[model samples]
Structure formats: structure tokens, C-alpha cells
Target chain A: MSLDTRPPRQTPVRHVATPRERDEQRGLPTRSLLLALVLACITLMVVDRTSGEDSPVEPVRRVVGEVLGPAEAGVNAVLGPVLGLPEMLRTNDALREEIAAQDDEIAELRREAHQNPYDVARAEDLRALCAMATNTGYLLAPARFSGYSSAQSFSSTISIDAGADAGIRPDMTVVNGDGLVGRVLEVTSHTSTVLLIVDADSTVGGKLGESLESGFVDGRGGLADGDPLDLRLVDNTVLPEQGQQVVTWGSEGTGPYVAGIPIGEVSKVYEDIRAGTYRAVLEPYVDFTSLGDLAVVVPTGEDTRVIEPEACS
Target chain B: MRGNSRLVAALLIVVTALLVQVTVLPHLAWNGVVPDLVLLSVVGAALVTDPRFATLLGFGAGLLLDVAPPADHAAGRWALALLVVGYVVARLAHDYQAAQPGPQPASTPRPPYLLMLVAGAGGAFVGTSLFALTGLLLQDPAVGVGALLEVVLAAVAYDALVAAVAVPLVVWVFRREPAPRVAHVLR
Candidate 1:
């Protein structure tokens, strides 16, 4: 068929003002021009603050994060090793003493290794069962620390080099071999931001190691303050002792944090008559200052990080 | 300088400061007091540019940081804080310039280094104090008052140091086109 050649019906023209025209409109009120911008910012702050995890700007933030996250991850990977040298040097003496102790333990373990092949196999099976029982609800994803918040003294968070691509999402509990680190706060395609447990706003449900008394633990956002987290117990009957370990009371699977992850040890305890809670200082197992790698707790039955527990490994 | 050139220069300064702040500055944190390169740049921009433009630029830069990864507070807190800082610094610069006369063509003669340092210190203090206060109102205070005060002092000192190097360079980049002498009006 011959191509239909005809003057196209005139499309209705809409007058969209050009950017230059808009700029030339000097009649625009300053009250709305600049004041409105600041006012809008304030409005957004209130909305975001009040909305918590379900904030409206989350999708926009995720898009921006996806674009920037990989680049940040690349830069951190290149720089982290070099930047960590001084800290390594500072801890050399301590490591040497620990290495000596580890050497003695290794010699004993080696001696035991030769004794019983049957017993060793049985022990391996038992260890696997223990790990299975302990981490039954967890599907963990490993991530590397990419960057930290640039604000001085006003924030404490780290960006990890893993995200939706690795089954990570906002509010997933994070941990290390030692204990609980924090949780995923915001996630992008290839990266996620983690709010450390030492941040002022972070709160978690924690249980005492021995007594099993449970309550809330809050972060103090201490950066260089030796102690930065606190725990509170509201049970008037149970008394908490110093050096007792605190662990998370695993939250809902899709909630902000997962359970059974160690939080810290109680360093100090004070009685609060009015609040009916005992406030205790926490000395965290993982140092917030020198974060390297962390793992996000994904729910079981999902694809997870290929990490074997220490007992099994 | 032409407005276009000035705009490019200002943007370049902000981006470079951001890159360095995130990548290199972390290693330099001394007792948690890392220098605020972005705040220094805003102060420097205000010292040379128009107040309105500086204020808007501050808002934009602050917004970029507020949303960037690792940011924990609400989205607009930094923007509001920096908006005020930029406006104050720009007004101070304008007033300072009004008090002095110079014969330099195309560009105003440099203000006293001490003046730039003072503006930097003031902006740093105000910017950090606002960040903390707004965070407090948001119920997400990253630190307590004792820590905030230490930060404000540390920021002032660090901004002064950064301004010594950054201000003159920014002044050169954003230098205004020369204008014929016009009589001042005193209301």
C-alpha cells in the first residue's frame, strides 16, 4: 500500500514556558522562591523523621544510591587497606601476645587430632547440629564496609558493599563472629547503609546471657568514647550483674534486627526507681570505629552468604 | 569572571570537596573531628559570590550530603542549616567589602585573611550547631551537648585552617566582572 501522505492533523499546541522565560519572570515572589525552598526542606525533614522506615523518599534515595554505591565501594576497596595500616601497627603488640596464646592452643588441638578418628567424626556431626539449631532462623549475607557518614559527631553509619543484589534489605540484622554490629538502614541495588549499634537512635531488644532477662538496648553514638551503648531492663524482680553478656531477642524475620546475635557485656548497672528499669552500660564486642566486614541476617529458606559457621569450618 | 565560569567553578569546588571528604578525610579523623571541606567551600563561595546565589548553593550542597549514603538524620536538616550559614557569611562579606575601597580592576581586592578566617569559624560553628540542634528536635541526636560543643570548637578550628588555603582560590575562580564606580546610598 502506498504510504499515506497527508498533512498530519494539527496537534493541539500547549504553551509550555521555556526555562529562560521562567527565569525572566521577575514578578515571582521571593517569599515563595527561597523561603519556600527552606520550608519544603523542613517539611520533608518532618515527614521523613516521622515516617521511620517507610519514608516516602526511600525509593528516590534508592535510585541515587544505586548510582553512587558501586563507585563508593570501589574507592573504599582501594583505600581501606592502605588506611588501615596505622591501626594495624598500633595493635601489633596486642596481637603478638594473643598469637602466643593461640599457638599453645593449636599445639594442644593438634595432639588431640591424632587420638580418635571415630570421635572426631562424631564431634563434627554434633557441631553441625549445634550450628543448625543456633542459626536456624538466619540466612546471612556478607558485606564489606565501604564508607562512613561524613558528618562530624552528628551521625554514625557505614555503607556496605552489598545490597539488594545480595538479598540485603533495610532493617536486616547485621553481625560479625564476635557479636552484633548493626542493621541495614537503607539498601540500593549493590550497596546498603548500616546504622551501627553505637548510633544514638539505634535501639534493639536484648536479653542477658545468664539470667535471660530481656529489655531494650540503645546506642550512644560514641565515636572515640570507649563506651557508647546502654541496656535497660524493666523487670523489677531480676537483678543484672556486671560482665553478663547481652544478646538480641530475635525480632520478626522481616523486622529491623534478627535474634540471638550477641550485643555486648554489661559494664555498669544503676537502679532507676521511677522508670522501673535498670540502666546498664554496654561494652560492645565489635569495635564500631574499625569496621571491616559485616553480615546481614536474611531469613532462612533464602539464598544466603556461603559462610560456614566456625564450629563447622 | 563571567557568571557561567563562576557557576562551573563553584560546582567543581563542591564535587571535589565531596570526593575528598568521603575518600581521604576519613583517614584524617582525629578523635572524631574530621574537617568539614564542604562547609569551608560554602563559606569561601559566600565570601566572593552574591548572597542569594551562595545561599541556594549551600542548600543544594547540603541536600546532596543529607541524602547520600551513611547519612542517618532526616533529609533536609543539613540543607536548612547550611542555608542559614551561607546567608550569614555572604552578608558579612558584603558588609566587609562596603567598608573598604580598592583600585583592582575586574575583581575586588582581597579581604583581610583574618576576616575570611573569622567568617569560616563563624559559619562552621553555626552550621554544626544547627545540624546538632535539628537532629535533637528530630529525636535522632547523633551525640549529646558535650560532644556537640567539642565538635563546634573543632569545626571552627578546622574551617579556619581550610579557609586559609581554600578561600583565596575560590575568590579567584568566582571573581566578578568589573563595574564602574557607583555612588553609595545611605538610607
Candidate 2:
């Protein structure tokens, strides 16, 4: 048959498929929709970055917090024992030591109780926090951690169960039985978010208890990596020895971090050759992984100007 | 009705993953990094859903994670990251199925476990890298660059491990129903 004349030898499959076929060939993905969603995400990030406190996303975040806060609390309560298993495993030795020490103290207390019948009252919990509050004359609001910052986040933050209703406010110092846990980042009606001292974004002025060497202590933000806090001394010449205690050097108006709250202990001191600076690594006293009860320093409206600066001895 | 049920199932999985990631995963972290369950959920959804739905699912899951309490990064970082993951994963899976020699039955056969794993790990690496890069560009990186790299590596491995378990479960649930959409593509 002549090329064009044999019943129009059915033209080789043209491959000129219809629009629907083309879509099927590509697996039915609407490229425009994907692009739109991507652009929307970029817009959101830009807005959230530039808007600061007033970002429209804030309300949505708040609403999520409002909805999830109680649910998290419920889940936390249910999972409390399971969650403590790891901490318990880690602190097994320390806890054993504490029990032995407490045994002797308990025996001594029993003898004392035998001598004086009226002295049977138990000591209060969170003695360090209460004592520090008493010593510094700062009013304290007690709270518990409701939830932690999402694992996916880079910042170390915690949601406390107390907030404006409990007189907790942003930038207030939060402490636990061990030492400084973090500072209140923001507050809602009944909950507050604390920015942990171990976050890379957080920097607190700290002083060596013995040498009085002051430095800026910032988190390595690698709590997951078991990284310690880095203390960059203002006086690069003075090298702090290992085991030196670090404490907050106090912030202006006693906000964010108060003076004298123990921060950490110098674990290792090293010099950076490139920067020509000596840096100390600190092991923070607070067991951030197992943070439980915490207290926020609420200003008592007392004459703070009269209160003397007290070292958290 | 089938489509709506599938959407609900995907939403349920993502939300549940988010709650667990934030509430329980921290205590289970190894060396300070926890598995990104929400991102894995997006991968799982992508495997079983159309690319369009997968992309949207990724954005929604990412937004929920971004705005979820304890999420301090820019609101859209995760959203953007997961959006890329969802679209890429679904597109790849779709094309893969489309290239198969015969007409796909109504009951879609599961993609090989190895393919699922590779897809999951790839999605995780892309999503995490994007999230970290955005953090750097925004000048609000949670850790130093060195530490951030470590986190990204740990996150990918952890996510892949969890996805091995979780993605199969998601695929089983979504694929149990005769997927008319997928069957239509093969025809």
C-alpha cells in the first residue's frame, strides 16, 4: 500500500494524549496546588519572623496551646511513671547515695523526736527554693511543668502549669529544687512557657562564686547531644578552675534571672586559639530532662531598692 | 465517601503523631534528638494518597507541628519542609506505580518494604535539611552549625527507624480499602 493511501495506515500511536491522560501520566499531582502551598508556607515563615510578638500566627499558636495544654497534662499524668523510668535509671546511683545519707538523718531525727514530742513536724519540700526565696526576699509562685517544647524544635522550652492567673509573668526567673531551670518566656491565663538555660538562644550573666569572675553563660543548645553550657568570661585572662560554682550575676530590675541562683559548675576550661579566649564549660545543676516542680519569682511590689544584693551562698 | 474517609484517616494519624512527639518523645530521646513523627506521618500519607492530597497533608501536618506548643521556630518552617517531602514522595510513588506493566487491581499491592524505607529516609533528610537551612537563614538556629548537623543526622536515622514501623501501619490502614483513585491511574 502507498504510504498515505492504505486505509490511512493508522498513524503510529500519536502520543498526543488528552489533558486527562497527561495528568495521569504524571500521577495526578496538581503542580499549581503544590506551588501555592509552598508559597503559603514561605509567607507564613516570613510573617512569623518579621512580626515578632504581633505575628498572626501567635493567636493560632495560643489556640493550639489552649487546646493541647490540658490534653498534654492528661497524657503526662498517665505517662508520668513510664517517663520517670529513664531518669530513675540514670540517677540510680545518686538516689542510692541519697537514701543512705537520708537514713542517718532519719535516725537522728527520730532521736530528736524522742527528746522533743512537739518537734515532729516534717520539713517542707523544695527547701532550697524556699530558702533562696526567703534569703532574697522575693515572692515565689510554685508551679509544675505541664509540657516540654516539641522534640522537633531547636529551642529548649517548657510549659508550666501556672500563668497570669497565678501571677507568673514573662522574664520571671524559674527555679526548682536543684538550681536555675529557666526563665518565663511568655504567659497565658493558666500556663507559661519557660526558656531553659540550656538553650543556645539563651544567655545569662553568671559569676564564679569564689573568684567572682563574671562571664556570659550560654547554652550549647545540644542538650540532646549532652553538650554543656559555655561560659565566656569578660576577663579572658582569668581561667576558672574546674569545680568552680557558677551563679546568675543578676539582671536589671531583677527580671529574667535574679542574682545568686546557682547556674552550674565549671566542668572543663579550655582556651580557643583562633579567638584568643578562654572558655569554661559548665554542667548545669538543674536536671533539665527530669524537671518537675518549679517556682517563678514574682515581684512582691516591695521596695526592691532597699533589698540588698545577696549571693546565693 | 471513600476519599473523605481517607482524608480523615490521614488527619488522625498526623495529629496523633504530633501529640506523641511533643508529649512522650522528649523523654525517649537518644542523645537529645527525638524522632520526627509528624514528618513520618506525612511520608506515610504520601505513600497512600494522591500527590495533591499528600502535598496538602504535608503542609497541614507541618503547620500543626510549627504552631504546636514548644515550637518556637518560625511558624512555616516545618510546613514548608514537609510540603516538599509530601509532594516529592507522592509524585515518586505515583510515577513508580504508573510505570508498572499491567493494570493495577482495585486492591493495590503494597510497595516493596525497601522502596518504602528509601522513600521515608529521603523524605526525612530533605525535610530536616530544609528546616535547618531555614533556621539558619532566619538567624534563629537553635544550635550552632556543628550541633545542627548532628541533630539533622540523628533526626534522619531516628525518623527512618520509626517510619519502618509506622509507615507500614499507615499503608495497611489506607490501602485496605479498594483504592479507586489508584486503580484509575493504572488503567
Candidate 3:
């Protein structure tokens, strides 16, 4: 009826919705959503990269790590009993064997002491060396073994329980009964990581006992057939033979690692045609694989005088 | 039923795993390789929990691992990496379930869940690599890719083993209750 009076009124028709449109409506925005996601990702990467280098996170990590400490201690403690069951069965037999070995060793030492008093004097000297090294006012902090990397891709290293809180500093020397384990490379509040001498990047100044021949001991990663460790003699002048002892020269005046701490005995020496230097592999006196406890040598500045220029020469 | 209990349990599990890894595992190393028990526990927890809870758990577990021993990399890297892993795994699971949509018929068997296993193992690999990479970038260049891969593989194997056993237990523990049935009787 209205059409008779005027043109029919036009109403705007709404567009039909597609499934894709519905999906889009239900989901996040394309451009905005992508922008948000990209921002988040960038933030995360930045956080990760920064976190990798930042030291301030140490305390937070330490607190979180406390959760594992007791549990780990409990597990380790319980494992002792669990492992002891088998050892208990073999106790008597092991005791007998150990006693015999000790007796033989004692007899050999006694014979050496009687025949060559110098051997006894050398033993006394080593003991004195260890004592003097310990007394150098270097704050010795005890550390428990934490973890180790089995990957041949990196250097051989072990984590310790002590950290910066215990005054363990980076580049500080680590030693066991035998000699140098490595140096502290990183420190947290409650833990520290030691880079072992067997690591590919590890370098130390060492000398032979008989010839006073000096050279550098360099780590070659993934020793042939993974024979624990390999050390390259960087100098051709000093030829290290198998069974000769190697000790830190302490030329750097770092008394944490004393001059005569036994590092390892030369296991093998071979002349390299390509390098023209003798490649001598060392089996470290400290069996890193079985290391349970360690001592971190804190620089006290007291023993700085021990490694005088005259003595190092 | 309380959330705190679950948190405490998770904490306990992680701590125990760390201790075992450091102390006993060294003695039990096979050709210098030790099983990553902490990684295994983290993956198992992430698989069964919500994303937020998984992230929290992962962060906590990672922190414990970072602190437990020879400190290599800086703190929080592991925590951050694990949080992401937990979130990713949870999201993937949600997407998978949403796609499948429906209760199984009585005659139907469950589908193979190998993808979830792979994801878990892959997460562990990523976590370890990030740890090594972070350490190298920050402190020393000695962290080698070969060694990082070895750790990743070891962690994956260990995580897989734990998942194989722990997944069923987790499923049983956290299984949802069936909806109530309404019966219509025809007289």
C-alpha cells in the first residue's frame, strides 16, 4: 500500500557469514594475534639468552635447588644401605683381599725405606708438600660431587656442592688427594662447576721429574676409543716417558695448586709425524668418574711467595 | 585433594631424583653415561598435569637440578626452558584431545600415544641443549654439541623409560570420572 504512494523503502541486507568467518571470530586475531605471539616469542628468547648469562638468578636457583638437596641426600643415604646389601655379602672376602694387598704394599715400602732411604725421604717430602699446600692460608672449602657430563663433545667436568657462598671463586684451583682436578669456571650461591684438566680446552704448565723437561699439557677431546683422557706435550724439548710423574709448575704463583701436587703419570708417549711433538696421554690421579668429595682452594695470598721465580725456573 | 599436598609430593620427587643423579648415578655410570632421573620426573609430571601446574613443576625441578651440583650454567635457564616445555606438552595434549573428541566405544582400544612420548623426549633434549648452550654462551666455549647431544639422548632414553611406567600410573591417578547416566523406563 505504501508503494502506491512512494518508492519502496530500501533496507540494508546483512552479509551472510561463512564458516571461516565464524572460526575467525571464535579464534584470535590474525595480524594482532601474530604480532602478540611474535612479541612473546622474542621476549622469551631474550629472557632465555639473558638468563643464560645473568648471575643474579643464583639465589632463586639456590632456593629452588634446596628442594632437591635433602631428597638427594636421603636417596643417597638410602642407596648406601641398598648398595651395602651386596657389599655386605662380599665383605669378608674383600676384607681378606684388601688386608693382603695392604700388607704387601707395606712390606714393599719398608724394603724400599731400608734399601733406598731416598724413597722414604721422597714420601716424607710429598707429605710435607701436601701439608704446606694446605697451610698456605688458602681457605679450603669442602665440596660434594654433584654431576658430570658424559658427553665427549665438551670437556670433562664435574659439579660440586659448594658455590660462591662458600667463597669458591671462578678460576680457583680444585684438588683431591692426588693433585689438580681442574679450576672453578662458574659459581652459584650454592654450587660451582669445575672444568677438569682432561677437558679439550684445558691447558696447564707441567714438568717431568727426571729431566726437569717442561711443556704444556693440552686436552684432546674424545681420546682414542675413549680411553678416559689424552694430554698432548706441546714442546718437543721435553719428552715425557710412560710412568714419569707430571706436576703443576705453579709458575703463575697460584698456590692453591702447589708445585709438586701429583697430577698424573704419563700413560703413553708417541711421536706425532704431523705435529712433530710427542703426544703423551695422562691418566689423572684423581679418578673423576668415582670422585665423591673435593676441596676448593681459595686464594689467601699467603702462598703467593711459595712459587718464587727462582724455584719455577 | 589439597593443592599443597600435590606440590609437596612433586617437590619431594624432584629432590630425590637430584640426589640420586648426583650421588648414586655417578657410581652407576655406564661408560661415563648416567641416566637423567630429574628429566624423567619432569616429563612425567608435565604429561599428567595442567599447563600452569606443569610449568611450575618444571621450573621447580629444573632449579633443583641447577643447584644440586657442579654449577655450570647460570641459574633460571633450566627453569625457563622447562616451563616452556611443560606448557608446550600440555597445549599439544589439549589440541590432540580436542580433535579426537568423544568417549571410546566399549569395543575400541586406545590409540597409540607415541607422539606424546616423542614430544616428552624431544622436550628433554631441548632442555639439556639449552642448558649447555646457555653455559657456553655465558661462561665457557668448551660446551660441545657432541656432548650436549649425548646428554640429550641419555635424557630422552631415561625419560622414555619413566614415561612408559609412570604414564599409566598418572592416568589412573588423574583419570576423570564418567558422567552420570539417566535411564528411561518404558512401562
lDDT of each: 0.75, 0.82, 0.62
DockQ, all models: 0.21, 0.43, 0.10
Instruction: Give per-residue CA lDDT, model 1, range A220-243, as digits (tens).
Output: 886687678888775865778999
User: How does model 2 score by TM-score?
Assistant: 0.51
How much lDDT does candidate 1 score? 0.75
True contact recovery of candidate 1: 0.44
Model 3 Cα lDDT, one tens digit per residue, A1-313:
3457756669756778786665354231334433444354335444544666554555655665666456667777888888888766767778999999999999998887797865555544345334535544334566767898678546677899988777777887887645678888899999988888777788877777667677666665542334445555555745678898877766444433446556788888787778677777777777666565577776554332232122211
- 1 or 3, greater by TM-score: 1
Which portions of model 1 miss their true places by more than 4 Å? A1-32, A77-313, B102-109, B175-187
Which lDDT tens digits does candidate 1 get at residues B62-157? Answer: 887777676767898888888888878887777677667664334545667888778878888889888888887876775778877787788778
User: Against the hidden reference, what TM-scores do the models get?
Assistant: 0.45, 0.51, 0.40
Best by DockQ: 2
Q: For all candidates, what are the clash counts?
A: 1, 2, 6
